[model samples]
Target: MSKNLIYLLGSGRSGTTLLATILNSTMQIHTLGELHQVYSYIKEKLKCSCGERLEDCDFWKHVLSKMELTQEDLSTLSQAQNYEEQHRFIPFVFLGKNASSDYSKSQEILFKALASEKSTWFLDSSKYIGRFLLLKQLKFLNVKGVYVIRDVRGVIHSFSKKVQTTRGPLNTILYYLLTNIFGQICAWLFKDVVKIKYEDLIENPEETLHKVYALIDQRYDEIIASDFVMPHIIGGNRLKSNKSIAIKKDFAWKKNISRPKQILYYILALPIMILNNYKV
Candidate 1:
């Protein structure tokens, strides 16, 4: 049986986590938050959304046992993954080049272990075009991508806020532009890709989810509020740990961001914003 994978692609802070969490409510759909960061999380001894250390998580323990991977093997896999998913290696990946055979084989093994008969589709909210391209090389897995985009102003405002890793206005604009450019290219290059706006998702979640379900060839059902639970997600927004799920539009950017800076962001992102039909 072929393994089915659905990847979320685009810049971060675009509500991919919320989208994935909502989709996880659907039967037979599993969300693996930022699967690309699994090795890093393990290395750093980070915690899963389930509130257990990654190395100690029952789910990851099972995955490790199934893959039969040792600590040393994980170290090697991490190095290979880093090299393969680097921004510089993207062109090579697109040109059908494999940076490391070991990485490719390990990824195949990992996904095989993750895919079970019970689950029809696995969602990876990695949000990177490079990782998405790398996964496409795994022919045993049927891969589809959702390019999730948010308004540039909103993204800028989110990044500008004081956080652990805050980005300046210029950096935020550049990151948004570069990621979306590659994301758009990937979406166009692949037939099994779809685009979703964060605004639409917040305003009409049921309708937005129906579109995502269609992309992954899943039948849609009205999402039940009680079905929302913190799954065995690896790394994502802190909201994943919350017991309650709230769907609301965050228009705080309009109020908090300075008018001058907003105008500058608007001008810088005008082209892509226009392409995405995002207005000021």
Candidate 2:
């Protein structure tokens, strides 16, 4: 079997989408946004940076069709559009909408059927390690996956923008510590896995993507040709995101993390950072 299927596994804000978009540009791949609706529905409502409703995209058009639903009946397909507020994990728990507690098995069937229908590549960017752990054991076993990791400081820095960093900072730091540690473990467990850093992917697109393409062994010309959503943010055209961002690099939320709070932030991150290194 050719390396026809590719999944982007990592936590949110770790540059999973950017890598996915580059793969979509690969020409041989027809990358879809996150398809964890089988395991998580949050992706169904989350808008791509491109600004289109994902369910309406051709990639999702193919995904939903195989699930035995149509555009007219999207409401009944999953609760993404309908459910306004939810814990992030609720949608991912696979609550028997398809009549089985084992969503991993059902997802594998959907994925295989999707592969059988076309020569396109599939990309899921939900960015959750728990989700990846569930799907890793499927029997189909022909998938080629990429694991995108960002510096933990970058992850905490990315989350400090919209929320209070009081406890949020610690939580974000812990999440980054936990998620990437899991990625490292998955690397040892799975054979078809490739790991890349988000900072490298964005700051040096061409060189890094060349490295990424080499790992997955996919051609890169067309993906490079297609327009990316955040060219400015990725290239040196913009400022770099701090290893741990208290404010968005765009300075879009400059007040979110103050210099004093940033001091506390670094202090908080130290133990978690040490824990990740020592425990891993």
TM-score of each: 0.94, 0.62
Distance from true location, Cα of 206 in model 2, Å: 2.1
lDDT of 2 by residue, 1-280 (tens): 3325566766666766556656555556655555554424323454333343445544444554566644443443244322321334433533412223334444544565464434555566655554554455455544666877765556666665553232366787667666666666667667777777665666666776666566556655645454443311111101122221111233222345666765555566555446334221
Clashing pairs in 1: none
Candidate 1 regions exceeding 4 Å error are none
Top-scoring candidate (lDDT): 1
For all candidates in order, the CA lDDT equals 0.83, 0.51
In angstroms, what RMSD does candidate 2 have relative to the true structure? 8.0
Please report the candidate that would top TM-score against the real structure.
1
Candidate 1 RMSD computed on C-alpha atoms after optimal superposition onto the true structure = 1.7
| Model 2 score (lDDT) | 0.51
Candidate 1 lDDT, tens digit per residue, 1-280?
A: 7788899998988889889998888776788889888878877888888889866887887876677777898888888887778888788788887546878876777887774774478899988778888888777778999999999889878777775468887898999999999998988899899999999999998888888889877788876656577778987876777876777789899999888877888889888888988776
Error of 2 at 131 (Å): 2.4
**Residue 135 alpha-carbon offset, candidate 2, angstroms:** 2.3
